[model samples]
Target: MQIEQQAAIVTGGASGLGAATARALAARGAKVAVLDRNADGAAALAREIGADGQAIGIGCDITDTASVLAALDAARAAHGSARLLLNVAGIGTAKRIVGKDGAPAPLEDFERVVRVNLVGTYNVTRLVVAEMVKLAPLADGERGVVVNTASVAAFDGQVGQEAYAASKGGIVGMTLPLARDLAQFGVRVCTIAPGLFLTPLMAELPQAVQESLAASIPFPKRLGKPEEFAQLAAAIIENPALNGEVIRLDGALRLPPR
Candidate 1:
């Protein structure tokens, strides 16, 4: 689908990759709804994007049905039904199945990660797609497109990453199936599994730690950029043929089990 003038919803739009995506979509002339749990940040970014009404920031919790419904309603009211949905809101945690003390990991920790990362994604997608299918198809017979965010850890999880990996792996596992399910409704689904990138959380680490992480990438020898992820997401939205695939933005790096 062409992004220009289309309504787009980006979860986690307060900061990091989601914020970058909101900016990219707005830059491409899409009427953007920046949805995030960080209400202040979201509103700030929306203000930064424009006060001329090209963008709106909404506080939303993707995991909650009521919150998502209200957010979708607000976005539709502001910009019309969204044709582009970016599922970028997620959380991560690192907990080993067996800890240093030899006690089992907390089930609540595992549940929290999956609830936010996996279930939250599906929650927003289903709500968005439900509305998407109601819209008439465009000239290319496409009603909408969805892009989900995963992590390279889904493929090669390291020590103490069972919860994180399982959550992301669920996303990776659902890409093709979701595409198939949505194909009949003229909506396409795809996922991006990104390796280490210089996100806000990553930036909080020491310089030496950051550099060590950067060196792990096989090529370019630097961390991925949020803009780079936004570029691929835009490409996927514009390219109708790139459906049901999980493209890793890892610079040909396969992680080691640390």
Candidate 2:
């Protein structure tokens, strides 16, 4: 799509890959709505890309239906109908189903992870996709595209990552089915499974742990950058033919069993 005339909604837009993607989309002339729990950060990003009135920020909680509906409305108010949807809000934690302290991992914690990473992605996509289906198609009869965030843990989760891995795996598993369901409407769905990236969580690791993680990648020998992720997102937006696939942005890294 010629991005200038396009409108996009990005969840988790307050920071990391989502923030980079919002900037990249704006740079390419797409109007963007930044949806995030961090209102201050989202508002700041919106102001940064005020040119052509292309960006706005909305406070959102992806796991809540009412919050999501309000945020979608806010996006439409700023950018008209959304043609691009990026699902990037998720949480990660490491706990075995059976913990070392003889206490089983709480079901609530597992449910929370699934709620934000799996159900949350589904919530925003379903809401925004309804709008996309209503939009007039591009020259190729394409109405919209969706990019969802998964994690390499889904495939090669280290020990103690049961909840996180399951959540991301669900995200990955939904891609193909969603694509098929949305095909008639020309809305493509894809997922990205990232390895160790230079995101906030990884950055907080001890230097030694971080270094060990970087060394595990087969090539590149470093952490993935948020901009690289944004680059892939831009490509997915531009290429209508790419759909129903989960692409890994892990620098050829298959994690080891912890």
Candidate 3:
């Protein structure tokens, strides 16, 4: 879909990869809604984007039906129904299945991760997709596209990452199934599994730890920039035939188990 003047929804848009994507989408002329749990942060970004009609930021909880619906209502009220949905909201808290003392991890811990990452992605997707099919297809019966964020951990699954990895793996596992389910409506689904990135928090780590992480990447020997992820998302949006695929944006790096 041509991004210019189109409406797009980006969850987790208050910071990290989501923030970068929201900015990139707006730069391309798409009126964007920045959906995030950080109400103040989201509002700040909307102001920064100069609500000159280009963006609106709404506080949203991806796992709650009422919250998400309210967010969508606010976004639609600001822009029109969105034709592009970017599922970037997720949590990455880590915990091992068993503690060093040998006690099993709490089930709620695992469930929370799954609920926020996998189920959250689906919650927003279902609502946005419903609105998408109502839109008149852009030429060739193409109505919309969904871009989901997964993580390289889904494949490598280092120790202490059971909850986080399981959540992401669920996203990778469902890409094709989601695409197939929405095919009849001309809405496509795709996923991106990114490697380590230099987000603000990561940038605050000690230099030695940062260097060690950078050295692990196969090529470029560095953590990824948020803009790089956004660029790939923009490319996927513009390409009509790219669907049901999970592209690894890890610079050819396959992580070793910790």
Candidate 4:
């Protein structure tokens, strides 16, 4: 799947990982549609990349089917159907299934996490695949590619991360099956499980806490950068052989139980 001249949709494109991906895809010469709930932020980014003349910003709530459909329609109108789907919009709220008081956590807490991270990912992927199937296949019969975002917490979840972990774990678990399901359609699916990184949310932490987390990494001894993740995504798009795998971007660090 060549990134050049292709229509790419990036969820959560307002900031963090999605933002980085939008910039990366644009740098690679692809027409990018920035889909995010932050309407102003998304529009700002599209303008930032407007030099390419193929970038558009759409406000969307991936958890809602109608919202996603509207966004997809807007993206299609702006730049044809998307050939690259990047599912990076997600919430990371840490909560224990059982609070310190031992009372069961509110059901909404769990559902909210899954809805935004897991269900939202599927919503975008499903709609993107529907469009990709309609596009003619390129070399090697490849029509499109989907890259989902997960977290190391899915495997090394600590205390107070039950909901978050489960949501990400669902992403990792679905990778292979999704790849297989889309294989016949010449579509590929893969996931990225990133470890502690200096995203905007992490940047909000105190310096001491940030340093502590960085020190925890075995090598490099620093947080992962959004650009590094984008680099990997570009590689994945360039290499068709990469599919149906959850590649971890942690710097040789296995999170400890908190």
lDDT by residue for model 4 (1-258), tens: 789999999999999999999999999999999999999999999999867568999999999999999999989988988899999999998777777899988999899999999999998898789879888999689999999999999999998898999999999999999999999999999999999988999999999999999999998899999999999988998899999999999999899988
lDDT of each: 0.94, 0.90, 0.92, 0.93
Q: All candidates' TM-scores?
A: 0.99, 0.97, 0.98, 0.98
Alpha-carbon RMSD, candidate 1: 0.7
* Model 2 agreement with the true structure over 176-230: per-residue lDDT tens digits: 9999999999889988888888988788889999999899998899999999899
Give lDDT tens digits, candidate 1, residues 175-213.
999999999989999999999888999999999999998
Stretches of candidate 3 off by over 4 Å are none
Which residue pairs collide in model 4, if any? none
Ranking of models by TM-score: 1, 4, 3, 2
Task: Give me the runs in candidate 4 sitting further than 4 Å from their true place.
Answer: none
Error of 1 at 1 (Å): 1.5
Q: Which ranges of candidate 1 are over 4 A from the true structure?
A: none
Supply candidate 2's per-residue lDDT for 190: 88
For model 4, give the 10-residue run with minimal summed lDDT: 49-58
Q: Give per-residue lDDT, candidate 1, residue 162.
A: 92
- Better-scoring candidate (TM-score), 1 or 4: 1
